[model samples]
Target: MIRNDIRALDAYHVPDASGLIKLDAMENPYPLPDTLRRTLAERLANADIHRYPDAAMENLREKIAARHGLAPEQILLGNGSDEIIQMLMIAADQGACAAPAPSFVMYELIAKWIRRPFTAISLDEHFNLDADRFLQVVSREKASLAFLACPNNPTGNFWAADVVERIASDFGGLLVIDEAYAPFADRDHLHLINEHVLVLRTFSKIGWAGLRLGYAVGQASLISELNKVRLPYNINTLTQIAADVLLDHFHVFDEQATRIRCERERMQRALAAFPDLQTYPSQTNFITIRVPDAGQAFAHLLKKRILIKQLGGHALLENCLRITIGTPEQNDQVLEALKELFK
Candidate 1:
C-alpha cells in the first residue's frame, strides 16, 4: 500500500536520551519559573478539554500576530512549522522545490514526501549561499518553492537577506525564509517580506516545543492559499490557552533568549581554544564545531553522557558537530568534556 518512493526513504530519527545531558535537539535549556508554572497551571485548569478546539483559533492567532507585528489574517497556524512545510508542498502540486544543500533536511524531505520534485543547490565551501549560481540553477529548474533557512540549520549561519530575496524573485516562486533561530540572531529578513516571501516561526526554540505550535507569516493572499491545505482545528484547546497565557508573559522568553546568546558566545570562545576543534560563527542559539575526528569526539562525549548533534556524511560537514546552548551548568560540563578529550 505504501508508495515505492516512501519505502526508499529513511525515516527521520530522534536520538534517545534516557540518561544524558540532553543537548542534541535545539531546545531551550531553562524550565519555566515556578511563579509562571503555578500561573500556567491555574490557566490550563480553565480550558474546556471536553470540546473540540475553536476552529478559528482567532484569539491565539491574534496574540501571535501581535507579537510578530503581523496581522492575524497574515498568519497560518500549524501543529508545528513541520506541518506548514507539508501544507506548502501539498499546495504546490505543480512544480519543484529547491533549497540550499545540507541546510534544513525537512525542506527536501517534505517535498519528496509529497512527491514534489526537489533540487538542493550546494552552498559554498564555508556553507554560505552562492547567490548567483543558486539563482541560476533554481530558476532553470522552474522550482515553484524555494526554502531559505535563515540562520540555517546544522550550519547555523544567516544568509544575506537581500541576495536571497533577489534569488527568490528571479526564481519566480514562493520563498520560505525559515527563521527558526531568529530569536537568538541580531538581524532578520523581515525587511524583505513581500509578495514572494514567507517567514516561518516556531515556539520550539523559545521553550514551547511541547505545545507544538508554529506559524507562517506572509502576504494575506499567499497565507490564504496555504491555509486551504491545512487541517482545521489543528491547534488543540489546551495548547491555545497555554499559548495565550505564556505569550502574555512573553518577557520571560525574551530574557531566556538574552541569556542563551551570552552563553553561545562564551561556548564558542571556549570551543575555539581547544586543539583540533574549529568553531563556526553562529547567530543561532547553538554553536557548531569541526573536530579533528568527529567520530572520536562524539564517542568520547557520548561515553561522558553528553549528547550533541553529530552532523556527518555531507562533504561540507565532514567533521562537524552541533551543540545546542544549554544552561550554564550544562555548557560547563560540555566544556570540561572537550578539555579532557582535546588533551
Candidate 2:
C-alpha cells in the first residue's frame, strides 16, 4: 500500500482542451513570432545535445541577475517555479503545513506530499489576505514555511504592498513570495529579498513556459541551503541557452507582455458590463470574474470550443472563473461568445 497521504491525495487535473481556444491554463496565447522562433530554431539546430549541461549554468544566472539588477550569487535556478516551491519547502525543513487560503494550489499539495502538517488561513470574503490571522499563525511558529502568491492566482489580485511588508517585518519564519505573475503586475517584493522573504519568479508566464525556467532570489546563505536540496544540473543545456538567448532580446518578451496587459484591461472593462457578472480588479494578465453560475458558464464556453478555468474547489472562489488574456482576436471571440451566453 502507498503512504496514506499519497493514497488519499487527488492528483492535479488538467482538463482535456484539444481544439479549444485554451484559455484555462493561464498560458500566453501568442506563439513566439516568426523571427524569434527562427532564431531559437537556428540556435538549437547545431547545438551539442550529447554532453551534460553546465552544472552551474553560470551564463544564464548572470543574464537573470543582470535583468533583475542583482548579483549572480543571489539567484538560484529551478526547473520551473514549481520546483522552486519544493526547494523552498526543503530549505524550511518543514514536513507538512497548511498554506494561506486562496493561494496557488501547489503550496498545499507540496506540503501534503512532504507529509508536513498544513492548514489554510482563509482569506476575507473579498479574497484578500487576512494579515492579522496570518501573523497570529506565524507567531505560533507551528509550520516551518508560509507561501504567499503576491498577485494571487485564480483571484488575480495583487496583495497590498504595505500588508506584505508588515508581515515580513513581523514574521520570523521563512516567507516565500511566489511572483510567477510578476511580469504582468505593477508591484512586487523583489526588493525584500534581503528580508525574511524568498521571491520566486519564472519565465513560464512571460514567453518561455516550454523551457521550464524559474529562479528564486534570497540572501546568499538561504539560497545556498536550497541549492543543496536541488538536483545538480536540474536545468538542461538547451534550456539555459534558450533562456540566455531570450533574455538577450528581452525587449521581445516585454512587447508581448505589454500586449497581454492591454488585452487584460480591455477584457476586464468589457466584463464589467455584464449585469450578473462581478469582475475583480487584476494586476496579473488574467481576470477572475464572478458569474451567476460559473460551472454553467464554463460548460457553455467549452461548447463553443473556448476554454477558461473554473474555480470550483478553491476557497472564497465560489461561482468564479478565471480567464487568461488572449490575443486581440481571441479576446474578441471570447467576449462575443460570452455576450451570447449572458444575453
Estimate the TM-score of every prediction.
0.97, 0.96
Task: State the local distance difference test value for candidate 1.
Answer: 0.88
Per-residue accuracy of model 1 over 124-215 as CA lDDT, tens digit each: 87788988988888778988888989898989887777777677567678888888998999787776778888889999998998999899
The superposed Cα distance between candidate 1 and the true structure at residue 250, in angstroms, equals 0.6
Encode model 2's per-residue lDDT on 1-343: one tens digit a residue: 7898699888889888888898887788888888988898888876788988889877788878888788887899999989988877766755335466787888878877876677787888787886788888766757667888888887888778888888777767788888999989998888777646889999999988889999999887888778998898899889987887788788888999999999998898899998888999898878999988888898888888999998866658899899999889989988988898787
RMSD for each of the candidates: 1.2, 1.4
Backbone clashes in each candidate structure, one number apiece? 0, 8
Model 1 TM-score, 2 decimals: 0.97
- Give me the candidate number with maximum TM-score: 1
Where is model 1 poorest over a 10-residue stretch in terms of lDDT?
A: 162-171
